[model samples]
Target: MKHHYWEAPIVIYLFLGGLGGGIFFLASVFDLIVAPGAGPLFFAPVFFALAALALGCFFLVFELGQPPVFWRVFTTKTAIIKWGAVLLTVAMICGFVWWASYLPLLGWQWAAGLAGLLAPVRSLMIGLAGVAGFGIMVYTGVMLSTLKAHAFWATPALPVLFTVSALSTACAAIALSLGGAVDAAGLGLLVEELIREIVHEVDIVLVIAEIVVLLVMVLSFYGAGNVTAQKVAARWVRGRTAPLFWGGMVGGGLLLPLALYLAGAGTAASEVVAPILVLCGGLLLRYLCVYSDERAPIPGEERYYERLKSSDTRFMTAWKQGENKY
Candidate 1:
C-alpha cells in the first residue's frame, strides 16, 4: 500500500523542530557547564527553546492529518508520546516561570524575585527538559529510519543526521534572532560575542560533519540500487526537488554557512544577512527532505508504479480499494 508524500511544510517543521529541540538541549548543557549563575541570559534561550519545541510539536500534529484519534497517543500512560507531552508541559511551565520573573511588574517583580530564588531548581528542571527534548529531536529521525519502505531513510546515520541538522538549524535560528538585535549596540555585542565564543566554532565543525554524513548517505544509496532509495536520491540530484536538496540543503545549509563562519563573518558582519541565509538554507533542507520522502517510490516496483497517474492518489486509492476488496 502506498502513502501520500510527506508535504514540504511538514518536512520543514520536522527538521526545524528537531534542530531547535536539540539546540535547546545543547544550550541547557552549556548553561550547566559554563555560565552557572548567569541569570536571564542563561534562562532566556531555554525559554525560547522550549517555546520553539512546543511550536514544532504543534506542526507535527497538523502534519499527521489532524486525526481525532491522535490525542490517544497523549493518553497512553506508557507511550513515548506521553513522556514527550509531560516533558514539554514541564518545560513550558518552568520556562515561563523563569522568564516571567524578569518582567518589570511591581508586585510581579517581587514575585519574580521570589521565583528567581528557585533558579537552582529551575536549572535542574531545564537540564531534564533538555534530555527529553533531545529524545524528541532524535525520535523523529528514528521514526523515519524504521520505515523499511524507504530504504533511503533506513541507515543508522539518519538519526544522527537529523540530530546534526537540528543543531545546525537551531544555531541558525538563535544567530538570526541575535543578529536582529544589532541596533541595540550593547545587547548586539553580547549576542555576537556569545555566538562567536560559544556557537560559531563548534557549528563549523558540526556543519562539516553534516555534509560528510549527507555525502555518505547519498553514496550508500547509489551503491545499493534499491529503487525507493534511488528515487529519493534522484530528488536530490535531478528531480523537481533537486535545487532545494542540492543548493539550499547542501550549499546554503552546510557549505555556505560553514564558509561564512570560517571567514569570520559572524563577528564582522554589521547586518544579519549571513545568519539569515543559514536559517533559510536549513529551512529549505527540511522542506526538501519532506518533499523528497513523500515522492519516493517503493523499492523494486518503480516501473509499475511510475506509470500510474498521480502516484500518491493512485497509490492510496489502490490501497483502500484493495483493502475493501479483501
Candidate 2:
C-alpha cells in the first residue's frame, strides 16, 4: 500500500487555519482600520475568526497522533511546528478579546472584568495577531512545500497560492459576518452597498491572484522534467484527479465565482454566492493537494525495479543481498 502520511486532519487544519488567520489578518488591516466605530468588528467577525482559529488548532492537535505530543512542537526548534503554533496561539488571544465584546450581553460579569483589564493593551494584541495571522495564512503552504520529497508540493508558488486563497476565504467569512450584523442592526442600503463593494472588489483580486499562482505551480511542476513531478502534475491536468481539480477547483471555485461576481455586478445574492463558491473551492483545493501527492521516487529505485523484473539472475542476487535475505 502507498504511504500517504497526511490525513484529513491536516487538510482541515490548513483550511481552517488559513481561513481564521485570514479573517484576523483582514480584520486588522481592512475592517478594523476602516470601520473603527463599527460594532460588527468586535461583535461578529472577530468571534468567527476566533472560532475558526480554535477549531483549526484542535485539528492540529488531532494530527499529532496524541494531543499531549503537541508540546513537542514548542520543546523543539521545529520551524514549521513552532511558528505555525505561535501564529494560532497569538491570533486566538486577540480574537478572544474582540469576541469578548458579547460577554456583557450574556450577563457575564467576569468577561466584562476581563475586557476592562485587556483594554489598555488591546491594540497591541490586535497588531500581534495580525502578524501571527499572516504567518498562519502562509505557513501551511510552507509546511507542505518544505517536504522536498513531494515534488507536487515543493514549489514556492504553493505558499503564494495558499496565502491568496486564505485571504479570499477570510474576506468571504467577514462579509457574511458583517452582512448578518447589518441585517440585525437594521442598517440601510447605503451600508450594505459599501460592505458588498468591499467584499466584491477584494474577492476578485484575491481569486485572480490565487488562479495565477496555481497555474504557475502546476506548469512549473510539469515543466521541471522530473518524472515524479510529471506524474503529480498529471493528476491535475491529465489523470484521475482532473475532474475535481478542473471542475471543482477551477470551475466551481475560481472561474464560476469570478463569473458570478462580474455578472451579478452588485446584486446582494450574487455577492453572497460568490464568496460561498470561493470558500468551497478553497476547501476542495486543499483536499486535492493532500490526496494527490506522490512521494518522489527513491534514487536508483526505477532501475532496480527494472532489473528485478528482468530475467536477470545477477540482479536478483544483488537485490536479495541488499535485502539481507540471501
Candidate 3:
C-alpha cells in the first residue's frame, strides 16, 4: 500500500486556492482599467475571490492537522509551499483591504476612511495581489510536480496545465456569480445582463487556452515511455479512472463548456450550467491528479517485474532445450 500524505483536504486546497488566485489576478487587471464604473464592476468578483481563498486556506490548515503548523511553512525553506503560504497571505490581505470599503457592517468609519485613503493606491494594491495570486495559482501545481518521486506529476507542463485550468475555473466562478447560480434571490446583487458579455470578454479566450494547454499536457505524458508516467497518463485513457477523467474533467469541464461558448449559446441558463460544469470538472481534475499519482506503482517496480520475466524466459528456454535433447 502506498502512503498518500496529502489527500482530499489538500486537493481542495489546490483547487480552491488556484481558483481564488486566478480570480484575484483577473480582477486586478480589470480593476486597473479605470473605466468610469469599472471599479464597482470588478469589485464584485473580489469578495467571492477572497472567500474562495479563505476557504482554501482553511482546508490547507485542516490537512495539516493543526493550524499552527501552517505558519511553519513560512519560516522554513519548503520551496513552493513557503511561496504559497506567503503569497496566499499577501493576496488575502490586499483583497481584504481593496474590498472592505464596500462592506457596510465592519466598522465602516475606519474601514471607509482606509479605503478612501488607499483609493489612490488601489491599483498598486490590486497589482500586488495579482502578482501574488498568479504565484499562488501556479504554486499549487508546481508543488505537486516538485515531488520527484511521483513520476506521474513530475512534468515540465503540469504547472502550465494547472494554471490554465485555474484560469478557466476562475472565469466559471465569476460567471456563475453573475448568472445568479449561487443565489437567485440575490439576483439584484448581480448584473445578469452582463453574463454573456463577461463570457465573451474573458471566458472565451480562457476556454481556448485551456483546451490547447490540456492537449499539450496530455500529449506530453502520452508520448512518454516511463512506466510510471504511462500509468498516470493512462488514468485518463483506458484505465479505471478514465470515466471520471474523460467524462467529468474533459467532457463536462472542457468540451461541453467550449461547445456552448463557440455556438454563441451562452444564455443565462448556460451561464449557470456551463460554469457549474467547469467548477465540477476542476474539482474532479484535482481528484484525478491526486489518485492517479497515488495509484501509480513505485519506481523500479516495473523493472523488478521485467527482470522476473527475463529469468522466467531463460528458464523456459533451457527447459525446452533439455527436453529436446532427451
Cα displacement (angstroms), candidate 1, residue 151, comes to: 1.7
Candidate 3 C-alpha RMSD relative to the actual structure: 9.9
Candidate 2 lDDT tens digits, 198-317: 867998898888888887888777777477778878778878888888898988999988988888876765667888898899888898888866766578876776666686776578
Window of ten residues with lowest summed lDDT in model 1: 176-185
* Tens-digit lDDT string for candidate 3 (1-326): 23367789888888999999998887776556523234455555777888989999898898786777677777877577888899999999988877765443333565666667767766777888888999988998898889877777777677887887888888888766542222222543444445436655577677777777766776667677376677667667777777887787778888887777666454854667777888887888787787656435567876786687787886777778886432
Which should have the higher lDDT, number 2 or number 3? 2
The candidate, 1 or 3, that scores higher on lDDT is 3
lDDT of 1 by residue, 227-320 (tens): 7777677657787667777777788767776776877553544125555666676666556554545335446565676666555775577677
Clashing residue pairs in all predictions, respectively, total 2, 0, 0
CA error at residue 19 for candidate 1, angstroms: 3.4
Could you tell me the lDDT of residue 135 within candidate 1? 74
Query: How does each model score on TM-score?
Result: 0.77, 0.84, 0.80
